[model samples]
Structures are given as C-alpha cells and as structure tokens.
Target: MSISDAKVDVVKDLKSEDAKWVKIQKVFYKDPNGKARDWEFASRQTRVEGSELDGVGILAILEKPTGPEVLLQRQFRPPVNGVVIEFPAGLLDKNETAEQCAERELLEETGYIGKAFSSSPIAFCDPGFCNTNLKLVQVSIDLNDPRNVNPKQQLEDGEFIENFTVPLKEFPEKLEALVSAGYILDARVQNIAAGIIVARKYSL
Candidate 1:
C-alpha cells in the first residue's frame, strides 16, 4: 500500500508503562533571579550511553552534471496524522557515531550511500514539548559511483518512504509547493530550505 493508504488506525495517550522509546520527565532548577522553576517534557529513552544526542538528520546532496540536488523523503508520521516531507534521519545505536548513522540511515531510507563530511551542533525540537535533539550531518553523494548505479534501499519492515530530489536552487519553491499540497514539512527541512533561500537571495 502507498502512503495514502496508511492512515492512523487509532489515537490514544500512551501510558508510561507502555513507553518504549520515550518517557515523561520533570526538571526543577533555580532561575537566574533565584526563583525555583519546574518544567515537564518528554525525553527520549534511546540515546546512546554517555551521549546527549538522540539522532542525526542527514543532509544528502547529490552531485549531477547540471547542478546539485538535495535528496529528500516523504513518509507517514502518525503524530501529525499526515505524511511528512523530511530529510533522511534516524536515532543513534549504541557505540554508533553520528557520521556512521548518517550514512546508514541515508542508504536504508533512500538507497544512496553518501559521504558524511561534517555535522552541526546539537539542535532540539519543540523544547517546550519534548527533549528530542539531532545533529545535522552533511553528506555528499557522487552520481558517478558504479555502486550507486541501481542503488537499492534496505528499509526495515513497516517503513514506507518515498525518496526524491529537487534542485538546490529551487528548493524553497518546491518545499512551498509540497506544503500547499498538504504535506507536513519537518522543522529541519523547513529551516534548511529557508536558509538556502535566504543565503542565495542575499548572496551569502
């Protein structure tokens, strides 16, 4: 079945006992003004031991004769009750580096093996609601690589992702169109697209 056929079967509040990947947490701290404050948010339970990061977002750039294209994906996200446009990403496993996670996730989700050149500082998602954090990993894919020819995805069961690319020059417009078409844009994707648009407009 396609993404359109993948609808949410049910919706309910998850019990703490049933939480396998996350947990509710409350933190009490003293504010700068000597006021005591408390905050409650959902925290991940899958972070590697001794590591603060929960995952890595892959920024896959494909080099083509015409120009560079950014590899992107569309997948069903049950939380939002819609399909989301997202960059390839996944949580880190034990003893896994962010770079290795980027390469593995990219290949599994998009069938593209890429070179992780760099990664950004940790960034959080919806700090008020959750403590989810991910590093943005920069990956480059060479179209000329023979192994890349007829690349095959290695997605796990129940994962349905559609991989495609748009020219980096037109990413902003393309992302806008996808939103208009009723696709939820992940915050990371939206911010990256906005960054490119702003940088090019100001010739940064």
Candidate 2:
C-alpha cells in the first residue's frame, strides 16, 4: 500500500483525569493481514499525547574569574532510586519560552542566577518517550551577587540537592567517570554532553 493510502482505524482517549499536564490519546491502525495473522500482528495501539510544555535545560556552569570552578549539583532522583550528579533542568509551562524555563530551573535547583544563554532545541534530549524537546541554557553566574543565590527557592518539595563548584578543566574527566560508573542516566548524560559541545562551539 502507498503511504498516502494509510488510514487510522481507531482513536481513544486513555488519559486519566488526574493527568493534568498531558492529554493521552490511544491510536489504532488497520491491519492489512486481517485476523489470519498472529495476535501480535492483529493491530497496534499507543497512547499519544501532547503536553503544555516547552522544553528547557541548564548547563549551569559556574566559572571563577581566574579560570576553573564550575557550579554543579547532586540530587536525589526517586525514579532511579538513588542520588545522581546532574545539571538543573525542567519544563516550560504554558505561555513560557525555553529560555524562561531554563532560568527558572537553574535558580530553583542551584540557588544561583547567572546570565542565561540559550541554544536551539534538540530532540536527542528526550528519545524514549514524550515529544518534549530540550534546549541548552548556559548560565554565567556571579558568585558575589547575593541576589543571585536563593536557597529557599533553590528546591521544591521532596527534592534534596547538594550544590558544589568543580574545576572547568576537570569536567570532561569527571563526566566520563560518572557515566562509566553508571551514576549518569541517558537524558542527563546526553544533555550535559550537548551543553559542553555548545559551550565550546559558541564560547558561551
């Protein structure tokens, strides 16, 4: 059959009322093999949905005037059932742009606000599920700016984060170790790598 001849046979809303952020729709495709084929070939369905989100992420790199020293955070992630060292990141709510989300997440997780430089969205940031895309925001922070850090606003309920600054020259090696040690998951690792690439390329 030609691609243009394809047609959707069914669609159902599978999202629960409690899932406010996304609306899930189950889509079914017609099977040309009919019922004679195995059960697996009978038909296919999936919950497809869109969210009220624009993607954003932080490359929250803290630098000292003399070189070296980059800010970073180690936080507990219940989904992984452990603590992981990662950059601050989150989604942009409705009516918010990617840049706005990046700034918000950085401050909320690191207690510091620096200049935020944004990059274009990358699909590699989210590969497993959800159409949500992400962009890198490089936050150039002033350690002496008291107005820049707010621990009270640095975290949300149920989140435990430890903030620290590491040497810029040591970041690549440290990231490699973290990945090799299985301390870094797919998305976080990919984002950090992308951030480094962008930072180097753009000199941001």
Clashes of each: 0, 2
TM-score of 2: 0.62
Each model's TM-score, in the order given?
0.96, 0.62
Predicted candidate 2 versus true structure: per-residue lDDT over 84-124, tens digit per residue: 67667776666666677787777777767767865655644
lDDT of each: 0.91, 0.60
lDDT, candidate 1, 130-171, per-residue tens: 989999999999989987888888989988989899999899
> Which portions of model 1 show Cα errors greater than 4 Å?
none
